[model samples]
Target: MLKGLIFDLDGVLTDSAKFHLAAWNNLAQELGIKLTSAQLDSLRGISRMDSLNLILKYGKQENKYTKTQKEEFAAEKNEKFLEQVETMTPADILPGITELLADAKKAGLKMCIASASKNAPKILSKLGIASQFDQIVNPALLERGKPDPEIYQRAQQLLQLHNDEVISFEDAAAGVAAIKAAHQFAVGIGDKQILKGADYIVKSTKELKLDKIVAVFKRNNKKVG
Candidate 1:
């Protein structure tokens, strides 16, 4: 049986990734660093500091900013992101997510969120689902973010569940990689090509089937032990 569900917040629970992209892109433009949409997409699911560093490295703008300057730029991006997110409503919940969460909770599965966003808790609160999760592991508590497995691992530990007892749902490549790195089964939600390594891929959260997720967990458990 699947004992827990670990979710990635931005793209999975809410459609806030676009706001993040906009914030970053706006900052990059102000800094005189031109970033293509493709480059911006690559930064998804990464921490603000890491994303800024990557942008600096790739844009060859590292020499232009001191550590303090970089921090200021990152702060500016987050400010814009928060401003945009202030407009989020319950309607912003991803398709089938409310139903999925309700079903999972009813099925006796513990739920948690493992996200790179520092504002995850607030977002959940705003959505009126803050109390739904048993735990929430976000960037604020971690030294690193997605693709590093720290946040996911922290969530697993907090939930007191083994890897086999839980499944991760993610939409970004970095999130999928982190879940897999932590030796957990991952359900990807988004472009199939980018989510090729996911144990299963669904076009949206609406496509998620609880029975199928549980069955996969059972099958994996049997194979492992």
Candidate 2:
């Protein structure tokens, strides 16, 4: 039986990713680092420092800055992003997300947010859904980012559920990889091809149903670590 549900916050819960991209683009432009929109897309499901590292890698100029400077850069980008998202409200909450969260709670499934964003608390608050989650696992407590499983593992641990009894919802390839690495069933939200690693795929939360999610996992019943 499914005992818990862990969600990736950015694209899965809301539409704040655009703000993140804008923030990163602003910083990149200032630093003489030309980042294509495609390159900035990779920042999803990664930690602040990891995102900074990816940007440096894209620019092929990691050797130019000390680790301290990189940290500062990430902070600056986060500040810009936060400013852009400060006005978010319940209206900003994604369609079907509220219903899913309500259904998960009613079904006795523990629910949590496992996001790479360090500002998860603020974002959830802005969306007026902070109280819906049992726990929020951001990048602050982990040594690694999404696609590594550390964050998801911690989230499952927090929920006190076995890997087989837990499942995750994600929107990015890296987030799906993290859920699989954590040995849980994955429900991908987005294009099917990009989310092939997931056990199940739905276009959006609007089309999701708890029965369908459980059915997929039961039929598969396979661990994928």
Candidate 3:
């Protein structure tokens, strides 16, 4: 049996990725740089500071900004992102997420969020489900970001669960990589074609069936059932 569910925030819980892309694009334009969708996609599941650095490097504009300038640009991007998400209500909760949370809770599974975003708690609060999680691992608490496995490892440790006892839900390639690197089962919530290393891939969070998730764990370890 799976003892816990770890989730990524931006693309998994909220439709904030589009807003992030917009913010990055807008900020890039302000810096006299151009951003491609592919470049924007690579920023998913990364911290804002790391994302800003990636954008600067990709656009060949790293020399254009000092550390202070980078911070200012990143801060401006987040301000825009928060402004856009301010309009989101509980109505914007992802399909099946509320039900999934209720079901998981009833089934005795510990639930937590492990996100690179420093904004994870605020986003969950805005969605009216701040108290749903047993624990939350945000960027603020970690010295390193996703793809490093630190965040997920910390969340598992905080929840008192082993890697096999928890299953992570992710929407981006980097997130999937992090979960796997942490030695946890990962469910990729997006097109499988786009995410190659996930243990299981689903079209959306709404399509996630607990039984199926458990089955994957069962396949990995006979004790999971």
Candidate 4:
């Protein structure tokens, strides 16, 4: 029984990952490093500091910055990211998401966000859909980031549902791995090859339909049973 849905905010909801990459690029430029698109893509579903470390390692400067300097860089990147997010509005909601959210609410399904971003709340508010979610798992409260089941497990716990009773939707491979590690069904909203670990894959939110998803989940569960 799928009683709840846990979603990853960035790619699954909106294209805020672009803003995040832009901000990270700004910081990298100041540090005399250039970030490639591949490197930026790899940062999806990753924590701020971890992303910074990866960027620094790419520039062969990981050990060059002290803890304080790293913290300051992360803070500066966040300020720029926030500036971009501030311009978001309900119109920015991804295709088919508004309908999906409304349909889920009508079906009495609990919804929550399980994102690596600490700014999840602010992003939600900017999109004007903060009230749609029953909870937003605070990344700060977790000990580990994506690909480690911690955040998704925490989200399931918050929803007061068994692991198998929840479905997690994500766009990143890391986020899909986290959902699978938590023993929940994962619906990947991206290329099939990139999110092969997911139980199901949809090209975009526009392909998400509650009835079809519920049917697929039931069939998958039956096979497992």
lDDT for each candidate structure: 0.88, 0.86, 0.87, 0.92
Candidate 1 per-residue lDDT over residues 36-84, each given as its tens digit: 8789999888888999988887789878888999889999999999998
Which tens-of-lDDT digit does each residue in 1-225 have in candidate 2? Answer: 779999898888898888888888888878888987668888877777888888888888879899889888988998888887898998888888888888888998888899988789999998989998999885776898889999989999999999898889998899999999988889999889989999999998788888788888888774432
Query: TM-score of each candidate?
Result: 0.96, 0.94, 0.96, 0.98
Tens digits of per-residue lDDT, candidate 4, 1-225, equal: 889999999988888988998899889999999888888788888889889999999899999989999999999999999999999998888999999999999999999999999999999999999999999998988888889999999999999999879889999989999999999999999889989999989999999998899898999999988
Model 4: CA > 4 A from native:
none
In candidate 4, the residue pairs with backbone N, CA or C atoms under 3 Å apart (3 or more residues apart, or in different chains) clash, namely none
Residue 29 in candidate 2 has what lDDT? 79
- Show the colliding residue pairs in model 2: none
Q: How many clashing residue pairs, candidate 4?
A: 0
Q: Against the hidden true structure, what lDDT does model 4 obtain?
A: 0.92
- After superposition on all C-alphas, the RMSD of every candidate to the true structure, in Å, is 1.2, 1.8, 1.6, 0.9
Candidate 3 per-residue lDDT over residues 84-131, each given as its tens digit:
888878988888888888888889999889988777778888889999
Error of 2 at 128 (Å): 1.2
Which ranges in model 2 have alpha carbons more than 4 Å from their true place? 222-225
Show the colliding residue pairs in model 3. Answer: 1-224
Model 3: how far is 85 from its true place, Å? 2.0
The total of clashing pairs for model 2 equals 0
Worst 10 residues of 3 by lDDT: 216-225
